[model samples]
Each structure stands twice: as C-alpha cells, then as structure tokens.
Target: MIKVVSKIMINSSAKQVWNVISEIQRDPYFWKGMSRVRTTSKNGNALTRQVTLANSEKCLQKVILFPIEGIHIRWTRGMITGTKDIMITQIGTQTLLEVEMNYELHGIAQVRSRSISEELRDEAELAVHLVKEEIEKTQAFPTESRKQWADMIHE
Candidate 1:
C-alpha cells in the first residue's frame, strides 16, 4: 500500500475549521481534481457517496463523520482502493489539520505508484491550503462582539 500524509496549521479555532470541512459534500470545491460528489445514502454518521474525478473516473466511497475530531473516508470501488483519515487538533490558538491516505493502486497504476504518490501529496496539500485560506479569510472580518468591543473602546 502507498501512503501519503499532508498537514497544515490554520490560524483559527478547531471549531471554526471543522465547521468548514465537516461538510463532506464540499469536497469537489476544496479537492481540485474532484469534479463532482453526491451522497448516495446516509446512515447516521456514515454515508456513501459517488465521486467523479476530473479525469471522469468515478469512485464509490463511504465517509464517516466524527464531529470536531476528524473524518474517515474509504474508497470502495474504482481503480484505487484506499482509506483517507483527516485528523484535527488544536495547539495554542491554531488548528492542526492532518490528512493520512493509505491506498493501493490496481491494474496499471501499480507500476506508476511513485509518481502517483507525489500527485496525491500535492493534492492533499492544496486542499488543506485552500481550507486554511477560507477559514482565515472569514476571520479577517470582525464579528459583532469584536466590532462592539472595538467601538466601546474607541468611545
């Protein structure tokens, strides 16, 4: 099995970070190469989804949500057989987001594992970078409490 791990530290609370990423349906937005995603079925915290990649290859995945902790995704069908685990941790005032992908390439992909590893790593990094940007961007604007506090201090 080929494994890839990517991590990013976001300047936001773990709750804020989880609020953005916990929505698994938004994968196509953060995951650049993913063309589309649709949940096929839901059983409480576990759901099945049909994901289509930019290359038009489709895969069936089972995703399990773990609230503010992390996510577990297993690709059940397609040329790739794998499981991706996303872990969230808080250190100081920042949130540490980590993605661990363990997958095996079938058919012709086995021979190209070396190159595929780099590609997966790149994708994973970009995805977390985008999420960090999103969370930071939102935090850039002051909320009601901050704004009110600033106004009172000025007054």
Candidate 2:
C-alpha cells in the first residue's frame, strides 16, 4: 500500500471548505491533469464516476463510503484504492483544511520503474493547492452551499 498526504490552510470557514470539496461534480476544475468527471451511478452515499485523465485514460472510481457529516471518503477501482480525508479546523473565520489521500497500487501496475508513491505525493500536493485556489477564486459559500454544509453538520 502507498500513502500520500497533503495539508493546506484555506481562508474560509470549515463549512465553506466542505461545501466545495464534497461536491465531486466540480472536481476537474480543482485538480490539475483531470480532464473530466461523469457520474455513472449513485446509491446512497456511494457515487460512481468515470474520470478522464489528462493523458486520455479513463477510469471508473466508486466512492463506496462517504458519510454526510464525515471528513473522509473511500473509493476504489481497478488497481487503485484509496481514501481522501478532509480535516477542517476553524481559526476565527479562516479554515485549516487538510486533505490526505491514501492509495495503493495493485496487480501488475505495482511493478513500475519510477516511484508511483512519489508521483502520487506530487499529485496530492497539487490537488491541495488547486482546491485552495478554486475556493478563493470563486468566493463560494452561497445559500445552497450553506445548505449542504448544514446537511453535513446534521449528519
């Protein structure tokens, strides 16, 4: 198993940060190298999406475990399996958002020349920065977003 973790502080509230990161539909905008995301299926908290990478490779990812009020989501498909955890702490009006991705390479894909762990680490860090920028740029946290935050809080 391989793990890569990245942490960042965003100038927003925990509820504000949660609203952005929890919505998978807007993922491509925040994560570089991700071209698109198409929702394939949804069952309760589980959502399956087809993700297109920048290299044009497509992968099906099943978000199997996601609690409405929780900070983590577990997903897996093919040789990749992982959990993305978003830890939020409010400092006045700002939020300290820590996103951690823990993934493992399986099967033949595990036999790679370059370090897959290193690549994942870089990607994870980039994801954190991108998320921060997206939130700051949009200045999100509208009524609907606040509703989602409220739902998550209630859960």
Candidate 3:
C-alpha cells in the first residue's frame, strides 16, 4: 500500500469549497487531468461517474461525498487500485483542503518490482497538487465561479 497526502489553503469559505468538491461531475474546468465526468447514478451521498482522463482513458469511479467534510473515491485500473480522499475545513476567512490517496499494486510482477509503492505515491501526490492549483485559480479570479459555488452551498 502506498499513501500520499497533500494540503492547500484556498481563499474561500468552507461552504463554498465543499459545494464545489461535492459536485464532482459538474465542473470539468476545476479538474486538470479529467477531460469529462458524467454521473451514472446519484444515490444520496454516493455517486458513480464515468471519468475520462487527459490521455483518453476512461474509468468508472465510485465517489462517496460528505458535505462540508470530504469525499472518498475509488477505482481500479489494470493492477493498480487507487483510493482518494479530499477534505475541506473552514479556517476563519480561508478554507483548508487536504487530499490523500492510497494505492495498492496487485499481481506477482508488482510484488517483485522494487519502488512500486514509491512510484505510485509520487504519482498520486502530483495529481493532488495539480488539482489544488486548478482549484486555487478559481479563488484568485472570483469571476462567476465564486457566485456559482456560493449559490450551490446555500441552496
């Protein structure tokens, strides 16, 4: 098992951040590597979505959303099983977001390969960092996004 954790401070309210994070399928602009995310089911806090990556790879991700707390998502690709957790907390005028991912490499080849865990951890960390940067760009520019996020939370 490989673990990677990343945290970022966003100049936004926790409610605003939570709203954006909860609605995983609606905003492709905030996610850098995802080309598209379409919801297949919406059963309360649990949602199943088909996500297409930048490399045109498509996968199904099972996401469990927690309003104002965090989201947990898991998916399997080939021999790699990935689990990602994203959390947001209010800190006065800003929001603190943390993303953690755990990956497990299966199969005999992975067991024989050295540094597989490190490689996976590095990839997960980089992915979370890129997402944090993408999300912060919205805060920096406040455009229509701030209002949209605020509306979602209040409603």
Candidate 4:
C-alpha cells in the first residue's frame, strides 16, 4: 500500500471551506487531473461516480465515506484500490484542510502507480492550493459570524 498526505492552510473559516468542498460533484473544477465525475448511483449516504481523468482514462470511484454534512469526505477507486480522506479543521481564524490518500497497486498497476506517485502527490497539493487560492480570492466568508467551533463542525 502507498500513502500520501497533503495539507493546506486557508485564510477562511472551516465552515466556508466545508461548504465549498462538501459538494463532491464539483471536484473536477478544482482538482487537477480530474476532468469530470458523474454520479452513476446513489444509495443513502453511499455514492458511485464515473470519473474521467485528464488523460482521457475513466474509472469507477465509490464514496466509501460521505461528507459528514460539515466535516469531511472520503472516496475509493476500485481500479487501483485507492482511498482518499479529506478532513478540515478550524485554527483560530483560519482553516486547515488535509487529504490522506492510500492506494494498493497490484501487478502492472504497481509500476504505473509508483512511476506517477510524485505526480499524484503534486496533484493533491495543487488541489488544496487551488482551493485556498480561490477561497481567499473570493473571501466567500468575509462576514461569517463567529460560531462555536463545535457548532460549526456539527452544523
């Protein structure tokens, strides 16, 4: 199994960050190398999407863990046994977003996965960077009223 962790600190409230990322359907617009994600099926909190990569390859990605309303989102790709966990935390006036990704590559996929591991890591960093840049540029929550941290997380 291969694991990668990426983090970024955004100059926005956690609530604001969660509001933007909770909508997994919009990931293609922000995440590098991801061209599109189309929902294929949904059952309660579980979701499956047909994901098209920037390279024109496509695969099925399943939502093993959905966004907990205002907390985090997690998904897995069966093709590569890949899993990703996106978590957000509030730190004073800023928000910390972290993504933990793990993938088990078998047979030929192992070579491909290893060869592109750096690129994969870079993509993760780039995604969060884009999020931070966009959020800071828009100041989407400039006027967000201060709420108890717990309240925001559970809201």
lDDT of each: 0.90, 0.71, 0.71, 0.75
Please, what are the lDDT tens digits per residue for candidate 3 over residues 1-155?
67777777877788877766766765456555567988888898897888886657676788898888988988755354688888888899988888787867566536744575565455555655555565667665535624677688988
Candidate 3 displacement at residue 135 in angstroms: 6.8
- Comparing 2 and 4 on TM-score, the stronger one: 4
TM-score of each predicted structure versus truth: 0.87, 0.70, 0.64, 0.76
Global fold similarity of model 2 (TM-score)? 0.70
How much is the lDDT of residue 115 in candidate 4?
68
Tens-place lDDT per residue, model 1, 92-137, is 9999999999998887777888987888888999999999999998
- Arranged by lDDT, best first: 1, 4, 3, 2
* Model 4 lDDT tens row, 1-155: 77889998988888788878877788887778788889988887677788887876676777744443232333354345667788888899998998888877655557787666777788888889988887888874447668898898987
Judged by lDDT against the true structure, how good is candidate 4? 0.75
Where model 2 places Cα greater than 4 Å from the true spot, the runs are 64-71, 140-155
Top of the candidates by lDDT:
1
Q: Cα deviation of 92 in candidate 3 (Å)?
A: 2.2
Task: Give lDDT tens digits, candidate 2, residues 55-142.
Answer: 5766677664343233555556645567777677777978777767777766655895157677767777887788788779988456
